[model samples]
Target: MNGLSPSRRRARELVEPQHWVSGATESVAGLCQFVLLLRLGATLMLVVAAVLIEPDPRTLLLGTLVAGTVTAAELAVLVRHPVAVVRWPVFVLVELVAGAAIAGLMEGGPVFFSFSCGSAAVFGVAAGLRAWPVWVVQTVAAYAVVAWIIRADDVPATLAVYLTGVPTLYVLVGLASATARAAVIRHVNLARSALEAIERSAVAAERTRVARELHDSVEKTLRGLSFAATSLPQAVQQRPQLAAELARTVAEGARTAADEARELLGMLRADDLDASLAQAIERACQEWAVRTGLRADTDLADVEAALPVRHEVLRIVREALGNVARHSGAAHAWIDLVREGSTLRLTIRDDGHGFTVPGDLNHLSAAGHYGVVGMAERARQIGGRLRVFSGDDLGAVGGTQVVLWAPAGAMAPMSDRVRT
Candidate 1:
């Protein structure tokens, strides 16, 4: 720390220490407003001081009239934002000249002294105006006024101190003017960016709303058609007597197709998990119970976690276990969901007469196990892999553990955490 105390040092700097930059900027604004008012007030005092000091009544009356006129004009400018806010520099030079004239005529004899009062007004005008080239003109004119004042009068050196030293005020004014301009520009840019962001968000929300409506109207119709198609074979197998019912399925399929076509038009318009392993061996207990007609115990906890992957996954679980139920003569089924780092591992193991891993991927399709095929396709599309394990002689674990490993992309992690 400096030798001086912090509070004392700050008081020395004109502005307080804390939040110095922000406080100074605000002060500048208040100072401008105060100084404009002060000029108006001080002009009245100068008029009175001139009348008291001067012996000539005519000179006093003339001085008072001039002071009163200038006061009224500056006051109008103080209250109003003029169309010629751009012509602020020109007006500032006029005021400085007028100030010099007033000072020269004073009987108290402070020639060029009134310049300080009006200089602040000029500097303030420069800061408040946004028009380009205005500040440059005012700055140049101020230097000219300083030079003129220094040369025009014959004064004692100490009284003429401003002639040499006033560039400090000019430099301070320039810095303040530049800073205020930059702050205003930044504010404008931020407002524009915020507006653009809001519009994009609103557009995206509208597109999603439209997509959901389309899915409800078209997707439901298409799904109904698929269910009808799958039902035909079963219907015929049961009711060979009703031949006309076959034609009804065709009409249903046409309506579904038309509905989907309309839905595709909607989607074209707008643009923008699993679990793991577990007690791997104990699942055999469930398989043993089902096969031997004993009570099966299944304490599986995977039904909820897999819901977001949607219905295809549920179909897959049922189909895989159904296979075990039909051929493997399995007793119990335990579904295990585990998280392994970023991947979700789902292991469905059953204690049964484990068979060889099916060689043909299309074999499940042939057996009308669309659920398994669909699930595999869905997993593949979602960056996941699926495998089946079986056989008693070669494998260490006797039962089948169909393990699925999926690369849960960025969106999936938060979803998994929420669902879990």
Candidate 2:
């Protein structure tokens, strides 16, 4: 606890030497500081005892040598115990007996020996055993020895000898140690809080990344299959002569299931959005135009202008277009992407017979319902709103119009801009 001085406590919390660099977990600098402090305490005691109390030079030198040897022995104990900290009863006992003996032999003040035992006990507890009984014993042992020495009429010194000089110093040392122990508690709490915050941020970030990936790859694949289902049925209904061809195309889905399932599972677990939005958008426009003979024009800017935006935007466009191709009897559809002030706007309007939006989109399109529902939710998630405008009075061929405007600024910037 004596280690908890403002400077020493701060050092332990902030500047505790980290020797983990260069594959060293050993406390090289800390050990040096520890030894340094112990030697310094011993040196201080010898100098003070010699100057203040005028002890025999022989006794002074003997105390210095013995304390120094004790300091070295304590260091060896640390090496032996390492992390499995012990009570260090031997160190405390040595300090109490040797220090009291030195005082008795010196034929001088009781305070000198008291300070030595108090200093040793403070460090000894650093071997662990912060229990109150241990603290009480250490304090009482040092207190009783110094009191008894001074109380004996033979040893000659003022009552101030025991009262002011040695007891006061020991009391200050005890206070300092208590302070140190409190600081360690505070430091541990702070480190724990900081670590927990980092962990939570990492978890939330990973979840968002995972959600975006699922929306992009696996969701796109599912939509594609749904579109195929729509296209195959229509082909079969329209061209009776090509019914066999349409049936065979549908049958091929079974042949492809093995590879498709593997890819979907991989997409679910591994986050890899390698396919660019530019490629995805271009492909969507081309496919719809080629299949339906509908004039589909896409106004796509720098596709990666918004990477997080891309996942939802692509889904919205693909979903809206797919809906038009299925329900609305439309010949042409325009998918427009433009940045309007702070908002990035997307408009998918088809020149087909548009009907009232059902109370629930799922109820109307259960066979292939995920696309529209997911698109609507994705729009809301990106701080954007998706509005379906299709009543009766827009044009001669009334059709569904979906408007999705996501803030250009809020979107996660292109991959190159976000530093890992």
Candidate 3:
């Protein structure tokens, strides 16, 4: 059966008709142009061969003019409006006519036959499977033209080869071009699907980050305000001093919640995340030093990482710095980012009086100290681990050291990672 092959059928089933049309028009435009360029070069060679072999000057001039005109027309169509060449069937018929004209003018010469086969390939690539009938018609026309030339002129032994071999070559080249076009479109579609999946994963990770920010900042403050307000009415009737204190606490908590919400919004709207990892980290350190008036030193290496890894690492660095400013009471801080083998290590140290770190970092969440807990969660999301070495853990010296170790090729989003 001369129907669609199994591979083509499978491709048709997988891709919608509209997608096929669009992909052929957009994804294969460059390929089509390349094939047409090859055809143009072959035509020029055929013309050169004809000029040297043909005895009649007028016939040679006319044939060269015809071939050049046809080639120019094809090039114009491909260059000016590539979409029309693939989307419209008229271009296929035009190519078929141009091939017949050139082959017939050359009296079915072998070089012209090859040029005609080139036309078949261009047809197959541009029109795909839907233009098989045009290819059949062109093949038959080629055979008919060659037969007519052999019959009219004194037939040579070699002229007999064009009758059978030319049509067969046309079919083979056409099929091969069609298969190649299908493969290219399939690969492009697969790549597009993967990109879309990655985008969805990134969106989900962003949502999770937003939820975590609210939970650690505004949500906690608002919950505390709600409790204080609930107690305010009862305290006012019993003890006036307690009611006044509760009122002040509620006012401060509300303002703190508002400020945190604004800061979260600002972070979300920031485009600094697009900067290089080194620049983003160095900028974070500089901004923190300026805000807290603390001496900051950085030893950052010029290294690259995936966006998600850089994102989590930057967030963790900011969180650790915030902890140093708020809790460590350190006058000086040092940050280091270096790559060790396949692992990336970031260390932030402060020479301040450090508190006792819990045996389990998760336990700090219960005490409303979510800074370290959040930093640990962020590290884990990027398939990394964080360690806190406080003064108690590190001999009797009073200082804190926060270290994060992550894989350098951290491309996957948090949704794909195993959460503990």
| TM-scores for every candidate against the unseen true structure | 0.34, 0.45, 0.76
Tell me how candidate 2 scores on lDDT. 0.57
TM-score-based ranking:
3, 2, 1
Error of 3 at 370 (Å): 4.0
Error of 2 at 272 (Å): 14
At residue 288, what lDDT does model 1 achieve?
A: 38
lDDT of 1 by residue, 1-420 (tens): 288776445433423222223333333434444555665566567656766776775655555456556656655664463322334455566665665565456432322333343444445444453422444554565566566666777767885685555544544554565465446445545666788798898678657645653554456556766776677777777876543465485576576568446534532331111332122212333443455563344333222333224222333454466556656677666665545666666666777778665675558766544435555665674467777777954376576767677643222332333110
**Residue 343 in candidate 1 has what lDDT?**
67
Candidate 1: list runs displaced more than 4 Å: 1-83, 87-157, 162-164, 216-420
lDDT assessment of candidate 3 = 0.76
Candidate 3 local Cα displacement, residue 166, angstroms: 1.3
Task: Provide C-alpha RMSD values for all models, in order.
Answer: 17.6, 12.8, 7.6
For candidate 3, write residues 1-420 as lDDT tens digits: 139886565444433355653354555666777777787687677667767876775665565567567767776776786555544366666666766676666676655675677777877777677668877887788778777877888877775774657677777888888887788788887887888899999899889878977887789889999999999999999999999999999998898788779767866765275666767788878888999999889877756687678877887888889889989889999998777777889999999999889889999988867789878988898899999999668786668999999888432332332111
In model 2, residue pairs whose N, Cα or C atoms come closer than 3 Å (at least 3 residues apart or on different chains), thus clashing, are: 1-177, 2-176, 2-177, 4-180, 354-398
Instruction: Tell me the TM-score of model 2.
Output: 0.45
- Clashes in predicted model 2: 5
What digit string (tens of lDDT, one per residue) describes model 2 on residues 343-371?
87878898887876666655545654555
Give the true-structure RMSD of model 1.
Answer: 17.6
lDDT on C-alpha atoms for all candidate structures:
0.51, 0.57, 0.76
